[model samples]
Target chain A: MPIEDKQKPQRNDRVTIRTVATHAGVSVAAVSKVMRNAYGVSDALRAKVTDAIEALAYRPSRAARGLRGRSFTIGVLLIDIRNPFLPEVIAGVNEVLGPSHYQAMIGVSDARVQLETSLIESMIDYKMDGLILVAPRLPSEILAKFAVQIPIVAVGYHDASATAFDTVNADDQRGAEIAVEALLACGYRDIEMLSLGERQGHAVSVVRQREIGFRRAMQRGGLGSSPAIGKIPIASPKREEAMRKFLSRKDRPRAVFCWSDLDAITLLSLAMEMGVRVPEDLAVIGYDNSPTAALGLVNLASIDQSGRELGQVATRALISRIEGRTASEHIFQIPSLVSRNSLTRSGSGTDMKQG
Target chain B: MPIEDKQKPQRNDRVTIRTVATHAGVSVAAVSKVMRNAYGVSDALRAKVTDAIEALAYRPSRAARGLRGRSFTIGVLLIDIRNPFLPEVIAGVNEVLGPSHYQAMIGVSDARVQLETSLIESMIDYKMDGLILVAPRLPSEILAKFAVQIPIVAVGYHDASATAFDTVNADDQRGAEIAVEALLACGYRDIEMLSLGERQGHAVSVVRQREIGFRRAMQRGGLGSSPAIGKIPIASPKREEAMRKFLSRKDRPRAVFCWSDLDAITLLSLAMEMGVRVPEDLAVIGYDNSPTAALGLVNLASIDQSGRELGQVATRALISRIEGRTASEHIFQIPSLVSRNSLTRSGSGTDMKQG
Candidate 1:
C-alpha cells in the first residue's frame, strides 16, 4: 500500500555484462558468452538473454570487450596508393565489410620491407582483429609463417604458398593464357613481352605468369621462330629505353605483350615518340585492365581481372577465419577476359572488331 | 665490478620514464614535457633529464606519453575510391609523412554525410591525432565548428573561414575559365556544361565555383546570346539519356564541358550509343586529369589539377600546425590547364563558329 521511497541513487553510469546477467537471471559468463555469441548456448536462453540486454540498453566498452579478441577493425596494408589496381580491391573489401560492424584502416607501406614490417607491427600493437596485405614485398615464406600466428589474408599475391595464410587471386595462369590466346587469335606472330623483371621472382608475379603463358602460347602456335624476348628492369627509367631497344630492332616482333598497364603505357609513349602506330607498326597487349589502359592516348588491349573481386574474396576468407570457420589456408580465383582496342588486331589494321 | 653485479642481477628491466623521472629528481610531467620538446623547460634541466633518461634507458609508454595530446596518426576521409584523384592525394600525403613517423589512415565516405560522420567517429575511436576530410558533403558550419574542437584540415574545399578548419583547394574558378576558353579557341560558341547539384547554405563545393566561373567566362566571350547548362541527378542511371537529349536537339551545342571526368564518361558513352562521333559531331572536354579521361576509348580533353600537389600541400599544412605553427586557413590555388586530345574540335555539321 505504501510506495517505496523514490530517492534511490545510481551507483555507476557504466553498464557491465555482469549487471545484464544479474538482471536477466543468468550467470555473468552466460551473458558474456551470449554477448560474443560464443558456442554452446541454447537458442531459447540466448533469446531471453538478448531480450533482457535490449531492455537494459546495454552498450559494452570496446576496450573491455576487445580483450579476448575481435577489435571489430580490419587493418589493410597497401604498398602503393598509386598502383591503380588497389582502389578496386579496397572497394571490394569495403563492399564485403560495409554492411557489417567491421571497419577498415589502411596503411601504405610504399613497398619498403622495413616500412611494411613496421606497419604490421603497429597494427598488431593496436590489436586489429585481422589484416589484408596487398602486394607485399616481404619474403612469402616469412609472411606465410608470420601469418599463422596472426589472423591474416593476402590479396593479389601469386607466389606465396597458402600454408600459413588465406589468399585470393585472379588465376594468373588462366588469365595469362587468355591474354596470350587473344594475341594469337589476332594472327600476330613473333611477339615480344615486357616483364617487370625476369628476376622479379617466380613464375607467379602475375607479370611472370603472363610472360610464361605468352611464351607457351607462342610455342604452341609456332610463332616464336625468331624468339625476341626482352625484359624491363623493375622501377627502372631504363624501362622505356629498354622498350626502345625492343621497338627499334631491324627485325622487331610484329606484336608486344606487357605484364602491366604501366609497361603498356611506356610502350605507347615510345610508339608515339618513335612515330610507330598501334596495331599497325606493332600489335600490343597488356595485363591488369588498369584504368590507364583505357586512356585514349594508349587504348591498350589488356586482361580485365577484377581487382575488386580479389579483395572481396580475401576479406571474406579473413573474416570467416576470424569467425572461427575452417582455418588453415584458402584460395579464391576470379576470371578475366581480353578488352579489344586500338592495340588489338581485328584482321584489319586500326579497327575495333565486334561481332 | 659492474660486470659481476650485472651477472648477479640486472636492475634495468623496468626503466620506464616514471622511474627515470624519480631518479632525475624531476616530476613525471617534466620528463614527458622534455620528451615532447614542449616549452617551459630550462636548457640545463632538459640536459639533466636527457642524461638521466639515457642512463636508465627509460622508454616512455605511448599511452602515458602524450598527455599534451598527440597520437601521431592522421585520419583522411576521401570522397570515393572510384575517383582516381584521392589515391594520388594520399600518395603525396605519404611522401611528406613517410620519414616523419606519421601514419595516414583513409576512410571513404563516397560523398555521403552520414557515412562521413560515421568515418570521423571511427577515427576518433581509433585515437587518431588529426583528420583530413577531402571534398566532404557536409555543410561548412558543421565542419567549421567541429574543426575547432579537433585538428582538422580540409582538402579540395574552399571554405573562407578559420573558425574550425584549415582549407586547401585548387583554383576551380580558373579551371572552369580554362575549360570554356579552350572550347572557344576550338571554334565553338554553343558550349554546354554539366555539373553536380550545387547545394545551398555554404559556398564550399568547388563545383559551385566552377559553374559560376563557366558562366562568367561564357559571358565575357560574348556567348551570352544562348547559354547552355545541364545538371545530372545524383544516383541516376539516366545521365546519358539527359546528355543524349541535349545533344540531339536541332540547335545542339558544338562543345560539351563536363564538370568532372565521370560526367564526361557518361557523355562519351551516350555519344557512342547515340551514334554521335566525338570531336566530329560534338567536341567534349572534362575536368580533373582522371585516368579514365586518358583512356583511348575515352580520350576526353579536360582540365588537369594536381591532386598530388593538393595532397602535398594539405599534409604540409597539417604537419606545420601540429608543430605549433600559428598559420591557419592556408589556401592552395594551384594552376589548371587542358590536355590536348582527339576531342578538341567539333567534326562537321554541329561545328559552330567561335563568336
Candidate 2:
C-alpha cells in the first residue's frame, strides 16, 4: 500500500445517528432534536428515538456532538503529576463524574506557563463543556479572559475576588497557622517555616498565603514579628542541598514547619542521615499529610487538607457554572493538624499501624 | 437569566478556519488543504494560508477538524493515577510530543475494565490520531477489535502475538531473574516472591510474567522447583493486613522479591513496626525503582525499568503506525537491579546520599 494512502484516516463502520433515526421510523432532524432535548419534540417521538438508541447501542460521535452543542467532556488541567496530593483530587473528581454523562480528560502542564496557556486554549477549542484547573500558573487576568470562553473552576488557587471563574481552596493561611500553633502548644518558642522558592512569587499562590499565615501566627504567639522563613529550591539536588544546610545551621530553630510534605519528608530523611534525632533534636511539622508522611519509617507531623474534598468541591462548582448558576462562587475548606512521632515522642497522633 | 437559558451553551466569537481563508484571499478548501498538507497544494498557497493563520490567531475547531480528518491529538489511558510510576511515563510522552503539533489528553480508568473500554471508544469517536494505553485491563481480542479503528500502542501489556496493535514493555521475565540472582549473590538461600492477588491471571500480564521468571531462576539456583509465591491484595486495608501477616510468619524466608515498589515499600514499613530489621532479618527487593523506593528512609532495592524510556518508545511506535506502518511491532527494554540497603547491609548499591 502507498504511504500517502495509509496516511488517510481509516474508516470504521459504526452505528450513526442516521441509523438510530431509521430504526426509530423518524426523520434525522427529529432524532437530533430529541437527543439534544430541543423544544417542539413530541413525547412519543422522544421515547421512540431513545428506545432506538438503546437497541442499536449507538454512541453519538463526540466530535459531531461537540460541534452541534455539548460534548459531555470535562477538561482537567494539572500543573504537575508527581505530587501525590494531585491524584487524590483526581479520584474525588472521578467519583462524582462516574455515574454522570460527563467524562474527564486530563492535560498536564508540568508547571510551564506557555504550555499551560496552550492547553487551556485547546480544551476550549475542543468544545468541552467545562474545565477544572488545579494549581494553574496563569495570572488572574489571563484566567479571567479564558473563563469567558468556557466554564472554569480552579482548585488550590486563592483568587476569591475573581468574578469570571469559581475558586475552591484548602485555606492555606489557616493551614500554616495550625502548623505554627501545634509547634507553640508543644512549648517550642523558636520556630521557623520552610517554603518553596520561586522566581516570581505571586500573592495568590498557596506558597505566599502560607507565608502570610506563618508570620501572623508567630507574631500572635509572642515570637518575633518576622519569624525566620527558609526558602527551599523545588528541584532535585539543589532542594536536598538546601535541606541539608538547614539541618546543619548552628542556630536552627527548636521547631520547624514545612510548607508541604514533598519537602518535609525529604528533610526528615536528611535529618536522620545527619544524626539529628527527629523530635529530641529538632521538632518538625509539615503540610498536606501525604500518604508517605504516615508510614512507620517516616512518621512526620503534618497538616491535613483533603485534596479529594477540594476536587469534589471544584467539580461541583464547575458543573453549577456550566449549568448556568455562575455567580463566581469561592469556597474554602479548613485544614487541621495530624501529629506524629516527628512532633514529639508521645505525640497524640494517629497510630502508624492504621496508616 | 432563566434556569433553562443558563443550561444552554454559551456563545464565543472564536476565529475559525473560514476566517483564515478570508484573510488569505482563498477558498476554505484551499486553506483546509494547506492545513492537512494534502497533495497538489502549491507552496505559494500554503505559505499564504500559514501567514494568515499566524496573523489572525485562528485555532481550528478540534471538533470540526476531527469530522473532516485528524484532530492532531493523541489519547493516553492510565489504569490508575495514585501509582507514582505512571507520572514518569506521562513525562516521557510529553517530552516527545512537546515540539510536535500533536497534543496528549489522558484518561484515568482507575483499573476498571468497563471504564477502560468506554474511554477507548470515546477516543476513537473523537477521531484522535492514536492512543497509548498503560496497563489496560481489557483482553487482547477486545483491544484488537478497537485497534482496527485507531492506532494503539500498549505499555506494560505483554501481547506480542497480536497482529493488530503494537506493544512496548520492559523485559519482565528477565527483571525477575536479575532480582533472584542478586539475592543468590548475597548468600540468601531461602527466598520467596510476593505477587498481586488479582481475580483473573492472564499470561500476558506483567505480574504473571514475573512469576514465571521467579520460579525459573529459583529452580536454576538449586532451590525448590515450586518456590513459594505469596499473593498480596492490591487494595488498602487488605494489602496492609497481608504484609503484617507475612511479617509475623515464623517460617518466613530470609529474602523476598515483591512484584512492585508499591507493595515492597509497604512491606518494609510493616517490618519496621513489627521489629523485623531490613537486610538483617528480611531482605526485600522490588520492581519499578520508584522515587519513594530510592528515598533514604525507604532505601528499597528495586529493578530499574525506566518507565520514561518505555513511554518514549511506545509513543514513537504509535506515531510510526499512525503515519503508515502496518506490521505489528513489539519492543522490549532490558531492566537492571538497583541494589540498596534493603537487599543487604553494606550492599554494592548506590549510596543513600546520591539517592
Candidate 3:
C-alpha cells in the first residue's frame, strides 16, 4: 500500500461544524446550536443537524473545543496515590464518568501544597470542565480562592461554612464517634487515639475532625477527662518506631482508634511482630475500611466511610456546579463500622447498617 | 474579602514571548530560540533571556504551549492502579520528572483495550510531550503506529523487535527461572506455576514471558518437559475458588510460583484458612516483591523487580526520545529473588545481588 493511502484511515479528517452546516443546508450557527442543544434550535433543525452529523460521523476535537469552551474532561487531584483508599475513590469517579462524555485525567500531588496548586492551575489552563480534589492539602482559604476560577468539589475536605465551593464528605467526626462507640460497646474503657503528626494543623482536615470526635466521645463515655492521643509521624522508620513504642508501652490503653487504615494496618503488623495479640492485648479499630483491612489475615475492624461513594457524590456535585448550579452543596454521608477479629475474640462485632 | 479582589492574585496575566523579548531587549524569535535551546542562540542572548525570565518569574502556560507546541507534560497510562507495584513505578517517574520542567498526568485504562486506546488518543489530543505506558494492553503494531505521532516508552511490555518505540523491562523470564531454581535448590521436585487467565492470550504480555521462563527453568532442571501450570482467574470469588481447589488437590505440586504478589498473598491467606501449611505442605513464591511481601505476617518469597527503577529508566528513555534520540533502544534490568517464609520453613533462600 502507498504510505499516504495506508495513513488515510488512521488520520482523522477534520469534521468542523461548518461541514455539518453545509451538509444540512443550514447556517454554521444553527449546527453549533444543535450540537450544544441550545434553546433556540427547533426540532426540525436539530433532526437535520443530527442526520448530517451521523452521516459524516462528526466527532468534535476536544482540544479545539477546549480552546473555545468546555473540554468535557474532569481533572481529579489525588493528594497521594500510594494509599489503597484513593484507588477506590478513583474507581467511583470513573464509574460515574464512564457513561458520560466526560473523561477523568488524574494528577497526583504527593501531598505537597505547592504541587496541588500547580496541578489545579494546569487543569484550569487545560480548560477542563471541572475538578474533583480528593483530600486536598490546601487550606480552605486557598481552595476557596481557586474554586472561583473553575467548578470544584472537594471530597474528604471539611469546610461546610465555605460559600465558594461545594464539599462532599463522609462526616469524619461522626465516623470517629462511631469507632469510639464500637469500642465502648465492647467494654474497652481505656482507649487512646492514634493520629497523623502533620506540621501545620488545620481544622478543615479530616484528621482533625476525627480527633475532635474522639475527644468528644471519650468525654461522653466518662472514660477520662483528657484521653491520651499518640502522634505518629508520617515518615518511614519513625512511623514504625512510634507504633512499636505504643505497642510496648507500660501504661498503654486497653484499646485504640486509628485515624486511617494506612496507619492502623501498619500498627497491626508491628503489633504482630512485637508479640502483641489483637483484641486481647490491644483492641484496635481503624477508619476507611480499605481492602487490606478486609483480608482474612489482617481482619481489622474499620469505620466504613465508603471512599467510592464519596467520589461519586463529589463528581456529581462538580458536574452540577459546571451546569451553573450556584448554591454550594455541602453533602455529608454517615459512616458505619465493620466488626472483625481486631475488635473481639469472636471476630464479629455489631454490624452497623451502611448509609 | 471581596470575591473579585481575592481572585485577582490567582487570575494569571498572560506572559507572552513578546513580553520576554521586550524585557530582555531581544526579538521574539531570539526568545523562542533560547526557549527551545536552538543552536543559533549565543551565550549572551541566553543569559539575557534567563535574567528576564527570572525577573518576571514567568511560567509558561501549558495549555497555550500545547496548542502551539510541546505541553511540557508527560502522560502516563496505567493498565490498572489497584496493583501495589504500579505506585512504585509512579514514584520513580516522579523522582526523575520532579527536578525537571515536565509534569506527569496519569490516565487509568482499567485493563480495557478500548479505554486504553481512547486514553492514548486523549493524551495526544491534549498535546502531551511524551507518554510512558506501564503494562499497556495495546499490541506492538498499534503502539508502533502511535509512536509515529509521539515519543513512547513502555515498561513491563515485551516487544524488543519493534523499531518505532523504546521498551524498558526487568528480565521477567530470567526472574521466573530464578524463582524455580530457588524452589529446586530447596529439594522440591514437584513444582507448578499459577498464571493469570486472560480471555485472549497475547504472547507479548509479561505473564506469558514469566510462564515461558518457568517452563524453560523446569526443563533445564531435568524435570518433566510439560509442567502443570494452573490458570487463576483475574477476578475475585472465582480467583479465590481456583486457589482453594488447588490447595485442596490431592496431587497438588509440592511448590508453586505465582505470577504476582497480589495473587500469592491471597493464596497465602486462603492456605491459612484451609489449614494448608506454607513450606510444610505447600511452598510458594510470587513475582513483584511488593511492600506486602515484606510484611512479617505475610512474608512470602518473591521476585524482586524494582518497579521504581523501571519507571525511572522508562522516563529517562522517554525524555531522550522526545529530545530527538530517534534510534529505538530496548533496555533490560535483571531481577533478583527475595526469599521469605513461603519458600521454606526456615524462611531463607539464596539471595542474588540486584542489578
Candidate 4:
C-alpha cells in the first residue's frame, strides 16, 4: 500500500517492519536497528529507514516494544468492578493520564486472591510500566514481593509501614470516627455498627481499620468499650435476610453506623419496605458517600472519602517511583461527613469538623 | 532463581530464558525455538530445554508470545464506565472466561471518539486475540476497517448490514415497543420519551432504534406519527437541569419513557424533590433494568435487556470468530418489561408480552 492509500477509509493492511525494510531496500535486521536507534547505524541507512517508515506509515508494535523496553502502558487491577467507588478511582487515574503518552489497561480480579495474583503476574509478563492495585485481596507480604519486580502504588490498602511500595488512602479511622460523632451529635445514645462479614480480616484491609476506629470512637464517647458491631453478609438473599432480621430485632439500637454506602443504601431500602422510617425509627450513617447516597429518595448521611483523589495521588506516586524515586511514601487525606436526612431530619449539609 | 527458590515467600527475582539456556548448556536461540515448538528442534533438544525450564521455573513473557503468536488475552472496550449497566456486561464476560485459559483486559474510552479510536488501535498493536466493544462511539466504516485486522464482536450497536464484524443486541426497537404498549395498556394516552442529546445521531445507536420503535408503536395505536421526545443533556449540572426543566414543563406528559435506567432513576429522584407522586402524578418506564431499578426505594419499571447475557453471547461469538469462522453473525435477544411502582399503582410483576 502506498502512503496515499493510508488515507483511504477501507485501508486495513498494517505496515510492519518487514514492509518498511522492503520499501527501503534493506535487510529486516538493518531496519530494526535503525528503528531502535542502535549505535552502529550510519546516517545514510538511518535516513533510508526513516523515510521508508514515514512513507509506509509503519508504526512499531507495542508488544514488540514490551519485549525490549517501555510499552508506555500502565496496568490497573481492581478487586471488584461492581463497586461504584472503583469507577470514581478509575476516572481520577484517567484524568491524570489523559494528556500524557501513557494509557491505562484495567483487569478485574473479582476479589479472589488467586485471580488477583494471576492478574498481577500477567501484567508483569506483559511488561507494563507500573501497576495501581485498588483494594487488592492479596496479603501485604505478597504485594511487597510483587512490588520488587515492578513499580506499585496501592489505593485503599492500609500498610503504612511497608518499605517496598507506596500507599494512598483516606484516613479510614478518622472517617469512622466522624460517622460516629455525627450520630452522637444528633442526641443518639444507643448506637450500633453494621460491618462486612469478610472471610479474611487482614489487618491492612479497610474494613478492619474501620472496625478499630469504630471501637475507639465508641469508647471515647463513654459508650461501652465493646460497643455492638453487627456482621452483614456480603452477598445477597442472605444479605437481605440478615438485614430484615436486624430490623425486626426487639433490641435494635436507635442509631447505626454502616461500613459502606453500598450496605447503607440497601438498609434504607429495606427500612422503607419494613415500614421503618429513617432517622425516625433508625438513624444511620455510612461511609464512601457514593452518588446513590445523595439521591433525594435515599438521602443517607455518609463519610466522604473521595476515591477520585486517592486514584490521582496513587497515579502520581507511581509515576514518581517509575521516574527513579527509591524511598517508599505513605499518603493520607482526611475524610469528612456529609450529613443528610438519614442522620437527622434537619441534616442536609457538609459537616467538616474532625470530631 | 532456581525452582526451589520459587516456594520462598520473599523471593522476587524473575527467572529469565537466559537462566534456562545456561542450565541446559544450550544457546538462547535453541531455547526460543524449542519454546515455540519450531519444526527444526529435535527430540533431544526439546528434552534438554524442557528439563532446564522445570529446574529454573522460567516462564515465557506474554509480550514475547504476543509478538509471534497468541497471548490468550481478550480486550474489552467500554465507552463509559460510570453507567451501572456496563458492569453487568463485564460480569457476564468474566463468567464465560473464568473456566477457560483466556483472560480479559478492559479499557475505558469515556465516550470520547479520539480515545476510543486510540484504544482500539492500541489493542490491535498489543496483538490481543480478539475484542468486544460495548456501545462504542466509532462509525461503522471505521469499525469495519478495524474488524479486518482482528476478530470483533460489538454489543448494543445495531448495524446488521455490516459484514466485517458480528453484533449482539437486545432488540432495542422491540424493547421500546413493549414500553409504549405497556403504558398504553395502563390507560396512558399522553406519553413522551426522554432521550440523550448525543452529538452524533448515529442510526446504529440504540437510542435511535428506540425512537423508531416509539414512533411506530404510537402511530399503530392511533396517536400521531410523531410524538413528543424530550432531549436530555448527558453531563451533570446540565443533565440535572434538563430533567428539572422537563418535569416543570406545563405540557409534560402523564407518562414518560427514558432511554436508560441511568436517566430514569435520576428523574425519579428529581420528581420526589419537586413533590410529584410516581404513577399518580407521572408514570415512567426505563431501559436496561439495572440493579438500581430493583431497589425497593427506586422500584423503577424498566425494559429488561439482560446486559450480562448480552456480554456472554458476545464473548462466545468473538471466540468463534477468532477460531476462523469468516462469516459475520448478528445475534439478538428479546427484551421484556419489569413492572414496578413507576409504571402504575398496581404494577408489581413481570410483563412478558412483546408488544
- List the RMSD of every prediction in angstroms: 8.8, 4.9, 5.8, 6.5
| Residue-by-residue lDDT tens digits, candidate 1, B29-113 | 8887787676678887888799889988564432222222455778899988777777878888888888887778788886778
Q: Which candidate, 1 or 3, has the higher TM-score?
A: 3
Cα lDDT tens digits for candidate 4, B1-355: 4433333343536677766876787888899778755557778888999999998868778898788777789999999998999999999999998997788999999999999999998898888989999999899999998898888999999999989999999999999999999999999999999999998798999999999999999999888978989889888999999999999989989999999999999999888888777878899999999888888888889999999999999999988888777899999899998888888876333333342
Tell me the DockQ of each model, to 2 decimals.
0.19, 0.46, 0.32, 0.40
Cα deviation of A208, candidate 1, in Å = 2.4
Candidate 4 reaches a DockQ of 0.40
Q: Write the per-residue lDDT of candidate 2 for residues A41-77, one digit (tens) a residue.
A: 8889999999999999988899988997899999999
Chain A TM-score per model, please list them: 0.78, 0.94, 0.91, 0.86
Ranking by DockQ: 2, 4, 3, 1
* lDDT tens digits, residue span B177-214, model 3: 99999999999999999999998888888999999999
Between candidates 1 and 2, the one scoring higher on TM-score is: 2
lDDT of 4: 0.89
The stretch of ten residues in a row with the least summed lDDT in candidate 2 chain B is B1-10
True contacts kept of each: 0.18, 0.69, 0.38, 0.66
Determine which window of 10 residues in candidate 1 chain A has minimal summed lDDT: A1-10
The better candidate by TM-score, 3 or 4, is 3
Each prediction's TM-score against the native?
A: 0.79, 0.95, 0.90, 0.89
Model 4 C-alpha lDDT per residue in residues A165-256, reported as the tens digit of each score: 99999999989999888988899989999999998777888888899999999999999989999999998889999999999999999999
What pairs collide in candidate 4? none
